[model samples]
Target: MSPSAVVNKRAVVVEPETTGHKNVKTKSVLLHRHIHYEPSTVVAAKGNYVELNSGQKILDATGGAAVSCLGHGNQRVKEAINRQLDQVAYCASLFFGSSAGEALAKELVDGTNGQMARAYIVCSGSEAMEATMKLARQYFLECAPAQPERVNFIARKESYHGTTLGGLSMSGHVGRRALFEPMLLGNVSRVSACNAYRGMKEGESTKEYVARLAQELDDEFVRLGPQTVCAFVAEPVVGAALGCVPAVPGYFQAMKAVCDKYGALLVFDEVMSGMGRSGTLHAWEQEGVVPDIETIGKGLGGGYAAVAGLLIGHRVIHVLDKGTGAFSHGHTYQGHPVACAAALEVQRIVREEGLVENARRMGEVLEKQLKERLSSHPNVGDIRGRGLFWGIELVRDKATKEPFDPKDGIAMALHEKGLEPKHSISLYPGTGTVDGKSGDHIMLAPAYNTTEADITLIVDRTTAAIEDFFAQRSYH
Candidate 1:
């Protein structure tokens, strides 16, 4: 029953099999080719690693797409879930409120300088984003005395929000949105992202670049007649699509100013960059700007539970509370008691154990190690990121900064090579960093509790994998 006793117990580490790959031949019951044709069958996981059925222990460098922030098998989160289940596992938010849900919402809202006074819990980041979009729309309707024509949303190109229809409409990732283009809503418009690596001009000053972007945003609003734009959605730190690209100084302020001038709500998609992944509890905090709405997931539950939420700022909440007295969205499993309890405990542990500070400390180490290891490599283009969230952009030529052809599948190859037995690392791979087609990059977001040894292991294994992959290509 004691927390110290639980900490003393060793976690069960699943080992890979020495036998030949049998799972590969076995037809999977689930739809397997959703992302890739052949995916690794993870037998088990603990701490900051996952064991594949192939008998390889992979250092989860990307935290399973940057989801597992607290790592695996945290006893406290597990205990919280058990306790919540005993009390109440599920309660409809419409009928009655659950303690676990109420506490989790309070913790999230209170942690963020009270910028967010209302929290809407959901099962995934995509769901949270959908709710955010709906909330933004509803807020506009409530505030506008007359039925306002502000139904349009402005989102940056190459940015990803979620997979659902509404979220997809707000997203501009070409590849992910291509198939769903016909079905996507028509209320969304695209703008350029603040990706300094790719978008910044070669000789442009940072201030000039930010100003130019601000002008572009203003121009877009003008083109759409400012009042037609309801919300401008963006990720404070561009994740997956651009590979951990943070906006340059004055970028967010400029964007926020534009939104404010046009009377459009500012929404931050912090699903991948929030909950201490970006050194700050909220990614927007680092930019010195606050958003009307913010969506957080992944690290919110620290991978101990499936939970995501949309944090509504006081301004937006006030409008809704005064008008409709309720949000126009609902999910069957919204604020599931067990998930809330697990996430609440995970967040508490993150705060109590000083993991956020640890993330900031280790982030410096990670940056140093990465720069030392790969900065001068011929194929390595640019290394950029902040806090513990980092990305290494790959190019065919460092001088020209030309990206490898998408046909080469360079990012996928690097990911596969990292997962090989000789290397055994789990990396997050991304493509289309350059013009949404030519560039490739890998993201590294190791667990916050990782030690220096873990950092060294990650760098070593990553270096070896890239070297081996290039070496084989040279031979070929």
Candidate 2:
């Protein structure tokens, strides 16, 4: 048998043969993202830990790409899901809508303080982003002037939007875009991301860095012919592509200024950073720049259901309302009732429990503990984040900020080491932190309601995992 077959065979666990005939367990036919090896079978999860079929309980620190904001198996969300299922599980959003979808959209719009006038629910971040792109294009067409020339988009480099083709076209993540480059649209262009650790020049003030980035964006708009640009897209806090890199202070404001100058919409893709992941309902709230169009997911459903939504600012809404009174794009599961209900309950729990504030408080403790435990380590080049989100960049030379060669797979190695029974932790790892081909970092995005003790455990296990990983290998 092949290596994958061997892994599949090992994954099977035969129950005790109580009957007269012998019983055998069947191998998993599920095609997981990772093809080379079978992933650990998670049998159960609760709070901050997930138990594998092997009975090894792993502490979930990253919340499965920062999706489980309220943690696993939330009773309230489960109940809400069942309630919606009993009432209306699914509906053709194009023809009919459910109370669950209406309530969720109203809550989302109100959460934005009316800045976002409408919410278009969808299945995932990719779908949300795809809708955002199409809406942007349609908005231009629907405008009084009918600027069909607006066909280009300006996005930041080293950012992740989503996985679909349109989302990929807007994303600047190199690895995710490499194989799909030929198939991606040509109208999308990229500017330097506001990554201070690596992008900020030595001796450069924060104001200067922000101004330079803003100018780069302005230049891109001018190069693309301002009239040809529909929007400038970015993540208020950069996610997986750069492993949770937050923008420098005044960064989003400056970017927004450039977009406004050219009459282009500002689109914030907050799939990973929104929905209280960064201690705020929307990441842009802290930046003081509300996006003209926004996409939110991941924590929006808190992993209870597959859901995301597009928040349309008044500017875009007015154009579409006045011109066509209809959005041209639609998905079959656009307003999934079960998903909306689950997300609504998750938001309710987050608000009632004051979990966002808790995330803010616990984030401080997590940062302090992480720095205290790992800052002095030679391989740890930088630790940065906001709220419950953070990343630790691994470097070969701390003094020079030299990233380990991509061939080393340092991030993946550390992630694997973290899963070892002794460490018993789950870490989110990312590569191409330096550019699109090099650099390594591990991310931590604990649940919004993570406590001080949980933070301590997380930091302890994380520190041990890092130390053990480095100890097993030598670099000169």
Candidate 3:
């Protein structure tokens, strides 16, 4: 832990990973206005596939950035949505109650063994994250007679929450936070992620690595004056930022102990990893530890609706009910009936049809296929993930562990190439795996209902695309 030791550790650099395709069609719309153009238009979607305006059917390998968990089209979810539309599309949660919303909340709570007492639904993950922050603050104000000064949060570096101001404040993704750094709130601190593939030391065992991370968390709490630290926030399985990296064994337990010692809340941002993405109803269940507040989205509605929610633990609920008599926050669309209906049906399908178990089964097949096909590839650095979520970390040199230059756009090239008519596959591309500036990786979060044949197709297409990409690179 010496300064020299830290200095000796090479820092990862993240750079742009894009294809220099000049002739691609451009859009006149503002879009994510700040970012550049060349957008592809989707004409339609069905089951785990999407058809482009060009009439090509591309396999959705990453589930539209891991949002389409139940696949592109699900009749059950569609029928539920249509049924809710027939009943009521939107109902004001402020004064009125909707059966869809009530039923969904009850379902969520029941699924979690009633560990979650109350639910607050929102339109997107960012809203849920923002609500979580405010709720955590309110919990502190209402509970603990000491009038604690704990207003700070401790989150891991390279983590993402959302795009809203509060969510941005809690997020530690360097690229996402860079431009908005000046406007972000100043109540958050960061620690290293439990990224064993990159963060673990050469000789360290997984147990030792987890212990070290736990000690680091303890030290961070002490440095920040534990009494002033309100919550420790992290993604149970890191999503976009690190390519679906799960924590090492015992890591969560150690961190939970530290949080308990400091009387700080643990917030799990399961926006991408929850709702059976990691083979469990809740990712925390896999860790054998529960968070004081849990944010869930993405797979919740399975892309059938825009919905996200915060599952408030009993302790936080008790504190809020006692002090404020209500949560001191509200959004116009807090609990949209249609969204809840969609999510309810999605959850029901997952449980009734047994998609969680399917995710577990296919996830093993995926891991085996990936390792067998790409583990020894010179540029394939590390392959890691849980359940249906997985990432392939790409490096330039296998022995030296050097990453391809960001200027090379290796990951993006792979993605663009995969979209070619011959390849007919779509991949989620990522950069900055080495830090916030220099590495490349491709993430895969296939649909939970994916069949064995579908898995084989994906592996075949992905491997073929990768091989062709490398071949072209060698020629270049």
| Pairs with backbone N, CA or C atoms under 3 Å apart (clashes), candidate 3 | 12-434, 13-437, 13-438, 14-437, 14-438, 15-437, 150-228
Most lDDT-accurate candidate:
2
Question: What tens digits encode model 2's per-residue C-alpha lDDT throughout 1-476?
Answer: 00000011223211100010112342547643433335667899999999988899989998987888989998889999998889988889778999999999998899888888999999889988888888999999989889999999999888888778988888887776776789999999999988899999899999999999999999999888999999999988787778778999999999989988989999998988888988788999899999999899888999899999999999999998898799988989888999999999998888899988898889899989999999999999999998999999999999999999777767766877888899989888787788876888888999999989999999999999999999888963
lDDT of 1 at 11: 23
Task: Please write out the lDDT profile of model 3 over residues 1-476, one tens digit for every residue.
Answer: 00000000123222222222234545556442113434566789998889877788889988876878889878888999999999998877788989999999999999899788888889899999888888888888888594458789999888888888888888777766776799999989899998998899999999999989999999999998988988999999987778889998899999999999989999999989998999888999999899999999999998898899999899998887777688878878889999999999999999899999999999999999989998877778899999999988888887777888767777777887988899988777776678866777888889999988999889899888888888777522
Return the clash pairs for model 1, or none: 16-55, 17-55
- Candidate 1: stretches off by over 4 Å: 1-23, 34-38
Candidate 3 off by > 4 Å: 1-27, 30-36, 146-148, 474-476
Weakest 10 consecutive residues of candidate 2 by summed lDDT:
1-10
| TM-score per model over all chains | 0.93, 0.94, 0.93
TM-score of 1: 0.93
lDDT of each: 0.82, 0.84, 0.83
Candidate 1 lDDT tens digits, 25-133: 5355665423112366789899988887777798889888787888988888888999998998888888988999989999999889777788888999999988887
Q: Can you give the lDDT of residue 465 in candidate 3? A: 86
